[model samples]
Target: MYTELNSILNTTPDSFTQGEFILVSDRQSDASFLMHHFLSFYLRARCKVCFLGLVQSFSHYNAVGQRLGVSLVQAKEKGQLIFFEGLKESLSVLISQESNTKSQAIDFLRDPSVGLRSLYEFVRCTVSSSSGGGEKGADGAEEWGPPVLLVDDLSVLLSLGVTVGTVLDFSHYCRATVCSQLQGNMVMLTRCDGEEEADDGDDEGSERLHRGLTHQCSLTLHVQGLPTGYCRDIHGQVEVCWRRRQGDGQHTQKKLFQYKVHDKGASFFARGTSSAVL
Candidate 1:
């Protein structure tokens, strides 16, 4: 793992500049370790990078928190702060890497060392709202909870007890309502057909869902556990089909994909090529 970290660190900044953030969607066999080592390397290298993970710091705090002087509540806030700080620093690295925001982000992750530098910055600056006045809300409505937009393979917009008119509505709600406010977004989706044999005869149904979504959704983020040849065409608002792969015993659930939509269409992106089309 360290060897891989070294190789990642050795990568040229340009290599990172060419790609977007790679959000690790599924937690594979060594997913946690992979993240741990990747982050350790990034921290050691002082790389600037962002991490999209489930908000589970409270459990860590509750387990061994008495060691710190702060109360459990305070400790929890501190943890959240740490998370946001890391994100901001990664954002900074994204800004500094190149002339454009997107370009620098590519560089920040190109090399493990540079990427770590960014990640460390993010961790250092983030402060949890529990610490103080952190996450803001609309009309003091209490910072909106993470906005969840559930979509099905049939491209049917699954209602999370709500209805969103267009793809942009979903993005804006997720962004302004949640990601921007909470600093993170959560997503869950079913894998493509044949990846895991559908217990029922839903292969054709799921494929239909996936293809039907191509027109309405403009963003597609690539992450772990997805089949090969998967690609999204947000610029043209099209979905590019790729060859399929069988599941290799990975948990593709509970993964989140951060997305942004523009006037032209929806552009899907995540920590990596793992896409989430809007």
Candidate 2:
């Protein structure tokens, strides 16, 4: 995990922010690093993670996980992580006697209008496995920490012919199950339409979804390409906003930081403190 990012996010290995929804939205740059950050952060926190990786394969994420010093292969082998690979799921739709999460997840491929209930069921089943007086370890302790559900990107469900309302509904149910019912955490990534894409009116649905999630999420990390354009030392900028309900009113605090990704981890800097500025 990134120490600088953890400080900015107020998340530490000893204590975690549970029962909260974190939304990661990307406008004009790659925000996959943020996804990696959380994946490792939660794993290091010992949370049982259900990863719905819609855009990449297991190996792809495993490679990145290795670089971050968290081995996805080992995690899965030890039954700590359950990964849903969209490519494999979409290709194989046969119902299995095994895990219902996979068999039900590709319902959209069979019928576009079937909705994402099956997919949501997968997540609910995975995270709720041992939260109650359920499973235990060999030493008679709880097998894992708090449950966590991480979706690399939620917009791909829309591109696959699911309605915006359906996707939002899925998110709502997942949020309720993870955050409210189980007292766990959820992290979801979505792409927003850029200026040109917005002008062309192509990805308005994604924009709506992003806005909808932003309102529901407790924290939003919106990543955008630098206004000054590309620089070798800087990748993009991130706007971090935290929201809380205070009686009848809501309070929001926002901050912007520039970040650069390196082989080990990423660094977040003040507005102009990166090497590019120096």
Candidate 3:
């Protein structure tokens, strides 16, 4: 992991808590690098991670992962990681010519009415698993750190013909299971309009989903491209928004940082610090 990120979030493997909902939002720039950061970050923390890779294959992630100093292949073998290759599975179902006949994990393609129940079930089962064998604690009791559910992007669900409510409910149920029941965490990646205001061309359903998640999530990280277009020194900027509830009131805290993505990892620096701006 990137200590720079850990400093900004004020979180470390030992200090991180459970029952959190982290929403990673991207406007124009690709934020898959953030996903890689979290995937490796959690793995290093020894948390049971269930990755719903809907946009890319496992091999793609494994390749980026090797540079982060973690072997996803080994993690899968050790049962520390559970992956749901939605991209590959959905493609196979599309080509098989046997879609409309049965209810599968991606029932959205076959019939929108089927919803994402099977997909949620897959996540619930994997994270709640009680299978033996893992690192033990001081008491010698098997310890699997709080489970984490990571979704690469939620817009795909909308693209798949799932309604806004359906996508929200899918995340809601996942939150209920991973955060409430299991005291784990949920990290979702989504997108929205980068303009100061919502754009007419923006996907309304997606915006609704983003709004819904922003309200539900404890933290919102908005990653956006630079205003001047391309920057040799800075890849993009990250806006961190934290939401907290006390008694009957809700409060929020926000921060912004410029960042550069390198091969091994990404670096986060305060605004106006990049050489490109100077």
Would you estimate the TM-scores of all the predictions?
Answer: 0.26, 0.91, 0.89
Name the lDDT value of residue 143 in candidate 3: 65
Supply candidate 1's per-residue lDDT for 146: 20
Which candidate ranks first by TM-score, i.e. highest?
2
User: TM-score of the candidate numbered 2?
Assistant: 0.91
Q: lDDT: which candidate is best?
A: 2
Whole-model lDDT, candidate 2? 0.86
The predicted structure with the larger TM-score, 1 or 3, is 3
Full ranking by TM-score: 2, 3, 1
Q: Rank the candidates by lDDT, best first.
A: 2, 3, 1
Candidate 1: deviation at residue 258, Å?
A: 29
Model with the higher lDDT, candidate 1 or 3: 3
List RMSD in Å for every model shown.
19.9, 3.0, 3.7
- Global lDDT of model 1: 0.30
lDDT tens per residue, model 3, 12-33: 9877967899999988888888
